[model samples]
Target: MSNIPPAGMSAAEWQTRQELAACYRLAWHFRFTDLIYTHITARVPGEDGHFLINPYGLSWDEITASSLVKIDVDGNKVADSDYSVNPAGFTIHSAIHRTSHDAAWIMHTHTRAGVAVSSLEAGLLPLNQIALQFHGRIAYHDYEGIALDLGERERIVASLGDKPVLVLRNHGLLTTGATAASMFNTMFYMERACEIQVATLSMGQPLRKVPADVADHVATQYQSSMGEEDDVLLEWAAHLRLLEKIAPDYRD
Candidate 1:
């Protein structure tokens, strides 16, 4: 068993715990979770260069705030936890965190839609509103088996190249943001984009792609719209409320 402090034991830590746990349940609610495969991490509040991640082997539906494991930039589990962190998962997340300091939260998942889109030769197309928003930002990292090798970190980081979202070719999806909610929201939209692409492709007809110039304009517009702090907080709170209604156990 892990010696996890009770939720609300520390105001900031508890808040991080709530947000991280809510992210897990919300991932589950959105059908983004797969057993213990995905991970959602939050930078420790007021703790420099440290963060918390799901204890390896725990399903998203069963994760609670306190049950999460604490780790440093090197992926070392400094906290008192019976479980170990997944090396492959840590390799991907730690690399991104080290590169993107503003990314306080990171989400990675392997949904069917995500993998399906990743296997496509065209990658993400500018065929719809959701797809066009990712026109110039999405990155792709060719899969090298499981992400267990630390050497892959350099390549993964190189491939992401300042982008907020990455599609692990032959694998799944990833998104980084300033908050767990924001990261999850990004993944939600990215996966939905992939799902939409797959559904559209299955129609056996040509896709109605938007013009490159228009896609660029819309992408810039979304980037601006996401800049407001109030908007981010409001969306975060709304997601938390939804999680509370759907999976109250995440707060336990």
Candidate 2:
């Protein structure tokens, strides 16, 4: 792959590609990736209905800024590239992006703990502080086998509604944000929450739930903290610095 930016691409689109690439590297750092499967997509700035996604065969760690593929909402390539997009995975992502304006960035993961929690009947429990952020704000979409069917698109949109997170029953986890930083932040905390839940359940003891009112209060506090600024920007910058130390080529 070439490190040079594609010719004629707008600076804004190039920057979005870089950020989306950083998100993939960060996901790998957090161990939220499942081999070459799953996807992280971001809306190309200034380009309506166009988005950036990883090339089909690359693992999260292998994805680079210039290697990302630009695709329209229909999963068709909007720009030339040597790589192809995964239509099956793009089904879920395209559906959400087309249906919701707030879904500027979407992330899906098949981590062990995320899938484990999705299999549970109760879904995500409000058993800890991190989990509380999702209280009453998360949506659950039932599994309907592999998501290759285009018909499942409407249902995926309906299941997601106006929520930021979706727990794919018997499947895995999905999160979205208006920016890549916010979406990455959501996935990081959510994946950690799932890991904690799984570890807690393994002790085979009853788990204490945070009171409903308190959980709601905490969730409210988190929402209020966002106000006008993207609260995750600073943290995302820190992540970029860390990535520079470990995998600087992702920015290529």
Candidate 3:
């Protein structure tokens, strides 16, 4: 549990670090990784303006509880780490953490299908059930080149506007949750939604659009289903169990 030097924080942060690390490994096993480029970050418990992210130089699978880096909103390391942090990653994440009060964990990805649907003008259309889950719940930010510039953060925050999912046009997908597990759940389904949208659109058939009312119901169903105790506990426990079977050392 003590992969990095003691930062004088509580045990809650260590637990968050372990979960964030496992999320990285799960992302790797599930093919959500983009080499060492994308990130999944969690806010440090009891600390404002601070969050945990993967060490920049390591692949997702190589990340562990102790190897995660803690950095302030200013992109400065708050703890002693042998690895550097990525400026671009913080540029995107800090904007949300700085503004949205509920975004305890933020997951960003550049998956092939995710980028594919993001490139579409319709942007995750209600073409299928999976895609419908995000009807009216997805937010869009026009392409603004690489996200390294600090000025773009404000516009990004404006576009997010309290939505759970943000689709960066011509880029990729991002999800926010009050917990790491909820955040992972959003990305897992969001990526699937994108994949379904791309596949259905590629078929080039006349779309059988879901009725607007039905889409609304489905979307609301998804929203209402969130934060349920049994569902959250079971799904996250299963994911942890699977990770334990294959990559148990993430807890290090």
Candidate 4:
């Protein structure tokens, strides 16, 4: 058993498509979607400069293994299909994928909690234990209109700077990982962290902040717990089981 499994395994393209489709279905199940607007993308297994994205205009729940669009880093479709991708949605993803191969999977969302946290001047405060897990690990990128410009990719990449999570300030949340399981786990926790932050702030009272050194220590503990065979995949497998029962058609 390998300590660190391959990122996006160089397995069959069908398997990659299946997991990518599962990512969409799980996002929909978890309400991480913005209609057909936001995107979740993955690097095509064994291929360079090509990726998979949900087709334009299909709600996240409607995404399927065969419906995902294969596109270049530039977001242009590379094969014949009934679907096409939203260029603007790919704008953020392409920047990271083009620059960081370690980020084989990326997720972006506009959930109310996520946006509320991002809109805060002090973003994603360490309000609790879960929130503390991200103390020194996340980055922020200022929202630049609607991510339609190619040149903004550079700045977005700079903001990311090898981090796995990026709060698109004044916009929403983003998470990256070498695998869909890892990325989705990050997205799930990141969203929950924002939800906790929002719930705490709504009280509108004096808040007790975690001492900075204690926060850093807890974050270090989290980082140490994750890399050994990635127990997050166990949670991801449980998610896949739930999806199988409720939305088996996603594997179509």
Best by the lDDT measure? 2
TM-score of each: 0.91, 0.95, 0.94, 0.94
Candidate-wise lDDT, in order:
0.83, 0.89, 0.89, 0.87
Q: RMSD to native for every prediction?
A: 3.2, 2.2, 2.1, 4.2
Worst 10 residues of 1 by lDDT: 1-10
Score residue 124 of candidate 4 by CA lDDT. 86
Show model 4 residue runs off by greater than 4 Å: 1-11, 226-228
Model 2: per-residue Cα lDDT over 1-252, one tens digit each: 233566887778878888898999999988999888999999887788988889989989999988999899898898889998888789999998887889999999999999999999999999998888888889999999999999999999999999989999999999999988889988999999999999999999988999888988988887787423445888888998999899988888
lDDT (C-alpha) at residue 169 in model 2? 98
- Report the CA-based lDDT of candidate 3 relative to the real structure: 0.89
Which runs of model 2 end up more than 4 angstroms from their true locations? 1-5, 226-230
Candidate number with the higher TM-score (1 or 2): 2
- Put down candidate 3 lDDT per residue, 1-252, tens digits, no spaces: 344534675788888999899899999999999999989999998898999988998999999998999999899999889999888899999999888889999999999999998888887878777777678878999998999999999999999998989999999999999987888888998999877777787899998988899999987887688546568768988999999799899998
Candidate 2 Cα RMSD (Å) = 2.2
lDDT of 4 by residue, 5-105 (tens): 23543445678888899999999988888998998999887789899999999999998887888899987788777887787878999998888999999
For candidate 1, the clash count comes to 0
Against the hidden true structure, what lDDT does model 1 obtain?
0.83
Sort order, TM-score high to low: 2, 3, 4, 1
State the lDDT of candidate 1 residue by residue for 39-66, as single tens digits. 8888887877778899999888999977
Worst 10 residues of 2 by lDDT: 222-231
